[model samples]
Target chain A: MSFVRAEGIFQSYGRRPILERVDVSVKEGEFISIVGASGCGKSTFLRLLLAQERPTRGEIRIAGAPPATEPGLDRGVVFQRYSVFPHLTVRENIVAGESFRTRWGRFGGAARRAALARADETLARIGLDHVAHQYPATLSGGMQQRLAIGQALAARPRILLLDEPFGALDPGTRLTMHDFLSELRTETGMTVFMVTHDLAEGFKLGDRVLVFDKPRWDPTDPDAYGATITYDFDARNGGIPFQTPEETLHALRTPGPDPVA
Target chain B: MRWINRQPGTALRAALVATPFLLLFLAYWIGSEIRLAANPSDRLLPAPGTIAATAERLFTEPDRRSGQILLWHDTLASLLRLTAGVAIAAAVATVAGLAIGLLPHVRAALAGLVAVVSMIPPLAVLPILFIVFGLGELSKVVLIVIGILPFLIRDLSQRVLEIPRETIVKAETLGASSGVIALRVALPQLLPRLIQAVRLSLGPAWLFLIASEAISADQGLGYRIFLVRRFLAMDVILTYVIWITLLAFLMDLALRWLSRRLFPWAEAGL
Candidate 1:
């Protein structure tokens, strides 16, 4: 049985359908990369997985049980920006992540000392130990994203969700971050669902790359239809098709049901 | 050179900062000299020396009847009331703002009401407050709170709302409860903002305090100023005005310093 499963999920804001008839299943520790054209419900699907928002229809199950109604310790997420707490020092931010395990959401005395030690180790691993006392604003974009990922991983969540985590970095920084993420994945072997606009990054990091597109479209009203999983490419064995570039364009070319008179 | 981009050196910056103040002082001095030349007993615009001497006397001398230094007595009274009003308002506003900003139900219940209340001129409600709370310290303090509480609540709530959705979601994913989110996640971010709101609303707070004192008060800086107004004691009034401005500036400076010391991280963005 799959560790993560979504059956016939549909999501919309009011009458505007963002996603419809979306189904996916993933084995434990499999990195699933979600890629699509802009406004194709890619982040919406990630949000569903995070349980930040529930689907309009259908349910998602993680590890044989329904996920928490709200985001919880089982899952951790990193966004492209504003992921780190601006008010906390780098060391404190990592400590904050681990502190959530406690009832009060803070550490003190011996536990706090232990948490600080663990945070130091994390900073060392992420190559950010030098600036552990500094704020997030002082760090370069790559460093901040690194801290964010480190902070997310501090709790050792079963599933790590990344929403275009490297979309804001420069090309050089992006490459380093990719390598950092790859190393972390190899170390933890945790389940990951990443949404990305860059297809190459998706293929490189994901075990299975899912393409989201609307099979039906209304040329007269663009938002008349919602996007669904159009293709699920096995990314592990160089299996991505050469025609994948045309997949989205092809979906756009497809026509929808007749518009109301 | 485009002056916009020019970085002033320390000495130059000091001179630049002093220019407007110097110009204003010079103008005041010139006007006072001309008025004094025409009418030596003119109480409308006292000479700078006369104001300074009055300030010295007010600061050092005791009142004949009460045997208490009136300036010190008035300042202490006013400061106590201002502190109590501002402190209470800050506490209430923080909690209410957090609730309104984070919880949808609370926001729905109170946001519009607060907006409506904020619109009503506080002075217009002064008589009603006097009637309700009486002319004691409570009424005076209540006036200050009523004058500035809405603005503080609105500002703090807006600031709380401005906190990135990602930060809150991230905290939740880490297994924080609503209380924990309010305490650990939201409270730290709001403290500096509270200080800023207080600093911003101080002007109105002082305005309310003075207005209330002027209307009805036995002992306060505002009371003293209004009391001597009938005698046209311009020197004493001018002394009080300068003293009040200095106190307000110092309070603002202290709060700013505290905010920086407490949350050095916020300095970059704030």
Candidate 2:
């Protein structure tokens, strides 16, 4: 069986649909990047996979089990903002990554020491060891995102969900984060699903890229429709060269007949 | 040298702060001198020396009937009532605030009621509290809790709401249960805000405590001050007022220090 199976998923708010009849299957340890126009439900899809939200119709299965009713240890997520706990030092933040594994979400004595050791190792791997004693606020934005990623990875989750995790970072920092993520995935061999507006980023990081879009737009009743996977590209096979977000969006809006077929 | 141009240094800032107090003391001293020259026994504004003497007596001398220093007894009594009231309010507010902030049903049910309760004048219910709780320590403590509880609950709930949705979702994805999210995730962040809310509530808390004490209490700072008011003992009243102000200032400082020491990263943005 596929590691993650989402079948005929449909999500909506009130009468306004966000995702429509979406289906995708991810193999174990595969990295899939989802790119879409703004407000095209890319993040919503990610939230569904993380089980932060339930699909209104159809079902998702992870590891042969039904999709989790709520977010759990098997799925770790890093958002673009407020991903780090400000009340904790960097070391404590990393330790908090394993909160779900411990009883009552806390580590004590030997477990605490072990968690700290793991936190230190994660910090070192993320090149954040020097700021271990510092608070997330004291770190630069890139460092904070790195700490967030480290914290998410510390849980040793089966899948890592990134909702534009590097969207807020500067160009230079974004490249560094891309490399860091690539290296971390290679080392951990964990499945990754990232939703981003940056087409180049999606192409660079993903082994496969899924484009979500509205195949038909009714300008009179815009809210009547929702996004679905319209284009699937094998990024590693050089199916298409990288396109700017604007160009990609334009293409999605004005697709040729039988675009998906 | 250029006072208007440059920001004050630490020592200068300290001196600048002291300047107002010094000027106020001088004005009081001068006013007392003028009043005393007109009439040697001016009860409305006692001489600074008389106020100082009252302070010395209140601090050092014991009451003839009770054989206990009145100032210490009053201070201790007032502190006990304040501590009990604030503790009860804080505990209740924390629990209720979390429930209202995190759970949509709870928020929908209670938010409006809390808002309405907060709008009712706390002092207006002083008589009702006395009628319900009677003329005892229970009444005084209960009055304080009633006065500050709504405000604390509202402030803390708002603070909890201000916590980023991402943080809570992130915690959940880490396998944290709802209880764990409330305790481990939300509570720590709310503590610093709780301290802040309490600090802001101190003035009103004291107002309720003193109002309750003044109306009916055998011993308390407010009781002592009101007890001597008939004799126009301004010196004793002034001394008590200054002492109360000092105590309030100290409490605020202590809470701020505690918040910083306990959760240094709270004020630092995530």
Candidate 3:
């Protein structure tokens, strides 16, 4: 069964459609990258998945129920800009997602110690155990982002959601994050859905590339940025052992600029 | 450590910075002394030494009034009032700041009240407070709260609101609940700013204390200043003024130190 499923996703802002009839599906332990041009509504789709924004029409399921008004530990997220707690120790942030773990941090004492211990192991996994006591403001951008990713994974969520997690980093840092993430993914075997405007990112990361095409925002030309689902593909195992741009190009036979056409 | 050495160059630079100000202050002190001595009977030109002597007396034999060293009585009283006032103000400021800063609806609702409150000078509330609570510590404390709360809430709330929205969203995606997002994500970003706002609030806190003390039941730094004013003892008045200012400076220093401890990387400096 698909770990995530979205069908007939239609989203619009003031009559300007962002995603129309966009369908997406991801299996367990799959890594899917959504890529498109700047206005491709890639972030919007991610936002929908995050429940930051809801689709005008469609259904989305994450493990079980779709995301709701209240956030749950089942879905973990990493943003482009590392949103680690600036004043908190790296350990505190890593355990931030473990609501299910520390039943009573408010009560303090032993429960809090357990929570701190959970945070400790997470920092260890992220190779930041040495800096566990350091604050995010003191950390390098890459380190902070790594902490953010670690924090999201702390509770061992069913799905990890990423929205251009490497977009804010320098090119070198971005590549490093990609490699680290791919390796981490292998160890964790998580289902990830990442959004990026760079086509290269789509090629590098996502197990399945899903493109969201927002038609246009111009009201004068009513049909501008018309929202459409350009294409979808099983980026990991559709056909070739490893799919390259040529194969992706051949796979996307549609008239648009999308590879999954 | 290399740069922070006890080098002659550092000392010379330090002396260079202090030389001009020190000389200027000496000139003023000497000038005032000369002017006061030139007219021993004169009421206006009180010698700087007189103020120093009064400060010494207040510090040592504090029983200047009815065998009571006014410093002990007044500093103790003023500190008690200020502590209670600022602590209450901190609680109010923090809660209001967090609420308005976090919620748009709360912000919109409270902005107008905050605006109206900010417009009213805290000292101006002395009359009403005196009438309501009498010329007692109660009135004084209430006045201080009234005077300080508006400025506290308005500034801290605005600062809290100014925290980057993207950061909050990022934390939420990391499975942080609303409380965690505000306290962990939003609060830390707002901390350095809140510390700044508290520093600013302390100034007004003391200013209001003096205004209230000048009129209320007599046992604060402001009361000391006022009573000395009646006897034309500029020494006592000046000493008290210096005392109050020094206290404010110390409070500011302590706050700066605490802030540094909390966020060593904080940029908004003294």
Docking outcome class, model 1: medium
Clashing pairs in 2: none
- Ranking of all candidate structures by their DockQ, best first: 1, 2, 3
List model 1 lDDT by residue over A1-261, tens digit each: 699999999999999999999999999989999999999999999999999999999999999786568899989999999899888899999998989767888888999999999999999999999999999999999999999999999978889999999999999999999899989998999899999999999998888999999999999999999999999998874555454565564665567532110
**Residue B5 lDDT (model 2):** 86
**Model with the higher lDDT, candidate 2 or 3:** 2
Q: Estimate each model's TM-score.
A: 0.93, 0.90, 0.85
Candidate 3, residues A1-261: lDDT per residue as tens digits?
878888888888997777777777778988888877776677888778777777888877887674465345677888877456566677777666665233332326776798888778777777899988877777888898898888788767788888888888888988988888988998899999888877777767777777666544576775555566677755553434455566656666655565432
Q: Which TM-score value belongs to model 1?
A: 0.93
Local accuracy of candidate 2 as per-residue lDDT tens digits, A49-84: 989889999788888996689888888899999999
Candidate 1 structure lDDT? 0.92
lDDT of 3 at B173: 58
Task: Show the lowest summed lDDT stretch of 10 residues, model 1 chain A.
Answer: A252-261
Residue A175 miss distance in model 2 (angstroms): 1.2
Output the number of the DockQ-best candidate.
Answer: 1
lDDT of 1 at A127: 98
- Provide the lDDT at B218 for model 3: 63
List the candidate numbers ranked by TM-score, top first: 1, 2, 3
lDDT agreement of model 2 with the native: 0.90
